[model samples]
Target: MKLKKIGNVEANYSFWQVLVVCSGQEFLDSGEDLIASFEINSPDVRLVLCLTDDLLAARELLKSLAQKLIALSMYELELDGDVDDNQRALPYQIARNVLLQTRLPTLLLESCSFVRRDITLLPAELQKADCALKLRFNRKGISQKVLTNTLWLLPNSRVDRFLAQAISGMAKTTSENEERKAVYKALQACRGFLKVAALPGRYADRSHKHEGFIWVRLPKEKAETTAAREFREKTRARFARPPEVIILHPKQDLGTKSHLENNTFKRRVERLARPGRIAWRQMARLLVELSWERGKPARLVPLPQWKITKEALKNYEFAKTIFVPHLISAQLPHPKAYYYMQELVPMLFTVDRNGWGGVDSI
Candidate 1:
């Protein structure tokens, strides 16, 4: 069967959107991390959640999340029978299918991995290129493999043709391992039409290993001075009026230090703080006091109590009504991991809120 086109290549989309495919309970556990990473790095970009599995719990999780993120959109993927059976390749197939329908410059984030740096800069990097992927190395360090699926960023100009060819290449493969090899071969086949660029030091894999990159921290005085200036600039751009209460929680740790060196902790803190500063910039108009409490827990200040917004409730209802029935009809087998999601839902609601507070502690 021929692929159906959903978007006009010539159509103009003013903004970029990121599509994240979530399937089972792993998403339920790490979904908030993905959202936080984006909020910290690319808050302006619209987030589209593509739920590939017919799991009611997965849809429910997104519905609750959408209320807090007004810019979020949710969609169900109608997977082809053969494609649906390949669990390893389902995400790629879903991405290839979604690329067919949208003209917006889109970045496909691997559902299991979260980015640590500013991903918004990738689209501009791809303006002159066809697609961009982060580079990874084997243990020997002599060979480099393109992380094509990990953080795939594609421009609208020729993305459809590229993905279509890549998917076609995968279709010819019989094994999961061969399917991946086919994608790499497909990149070579489309070299003339596609220019794959490398995004280094910008992403981390599932193991949370920082591939041979060394992080150099700026001098403390210079770093704070720069952060304050950038904070002021971003605040003015995002909000017409300044926010009344601006809380800076720099001490919060994301618990991603298992593979990081002790010295790299400070650099990681500094890197994480950039997103916090960007995220909370709108909450403060002027920089009144700048203080650094290195290695100290931020003293909690009483803020307004968070309540579930009407939009969130509405989205929950929409998920239960619209997505549930469709998912049921698809009859996708519910994985055992999905059962654990129910236990996490309440914790998800309590921990995830729109307010400026810490979800993790150092």
Candidate 2:
């Protein structure tokens, strides 16, 4: 902190300008860790949370958070693809949208990341470069060629004048080629932010020079073998297991109702709740059948919509749900995290066409 005499009045400020983009609730717990670590040590650091896909949805949930110790702010960025609209995927959208955000020296991190040590060292290193890149890989070891989207840092000098449109344009093509291409595209964006070099107007060959990226290997998520086994047993015992289930999202299903009021809105809610009610109806049938066949109570599995389909998911995760990280894997912990979420937060009980647990619900 510093104080300067401006004419007669005194002014105060911190030594460094720091910004962090914490996106998604899957990372909110880890976000808390970032906040506590940064705020306690550096009182002047500014933290920003970026919530994508839905603005009203995120606002509703965030307002419910009662942690007074926490202090932060948010900006809603719509980062999702529309197949019917034939739109570009999120990565490109992210590249384009991020260009317009703050022009200060900034540090970007995902919801999965936690500050392992003092972050002061990170800023010091980043100050040397126009842009610094970091990525996490899924493989056992780290590779520069294969990059994961996790973090980026940039100083204000370059960001104040970077070409937003070009970086976003490159992302469009990069996302289409392959995973390696996507990695290359992000690198290009960093360079653009620094004004070191701008990508050519025309798309180039698959290969490109690797620049300032520093690969950091993160610890693998926790194990959930027992959770999966228990879930399987419960599913088999009660309902013979479902084939597939669709987890509806408000932005995709109920966005049309965003402007409705009174009776119009009520009608949309009833219409949207149809799917959840139907799933409950199926559960009811399965319960009755199990009661007759087993002569006693049988363990009911997660609602059909809650079943985990992706073999890669941990802790019986449903990808789109807030439980993806904390509740799905033993890795993340939160106030009303994972399976216990609905018990503490009533909004999580249902996800459907209408916004109940959704953002616009309130």
Using lDDT, give the best candidate's number: 1
Give one clash count per candidate, in the order shown: 0, 4
Q: What is the lDDT of residue 150 in candidate 1?
A: 47
For model 2, state the Cα shift of residue 350 in Å: 56
Q: Give TM-scores for every candidate, taking all chains together and pairing residue i with residue i.
A: 0.50, 0.36
True-vs-predicted CA distance for residue 233, candidate 1, Å: 27
Query: What lDDT tens digits, residue by residue, belong to model 1 across residues 184-271?
Result: 6666777786777765544433333333111112223543245433543442232222222222211122222233244232343353
Among these predicted structures, which one has the highest TM-score? 1
TM-score of 1: 0.50
Residue 168 miss distance in model 2 (angstroms): 4.5
Model 2 Cα lDDT, one tens digit per residue, 189-219: 5554453322211111011112212112233
Write out the backbone clash pairs for model 2.
27-111, 57-359, 315-328, 327-338
| Native-to-model Cα distance after best TM-score fit, residue 67 in candidate 2, in Å | 5.2
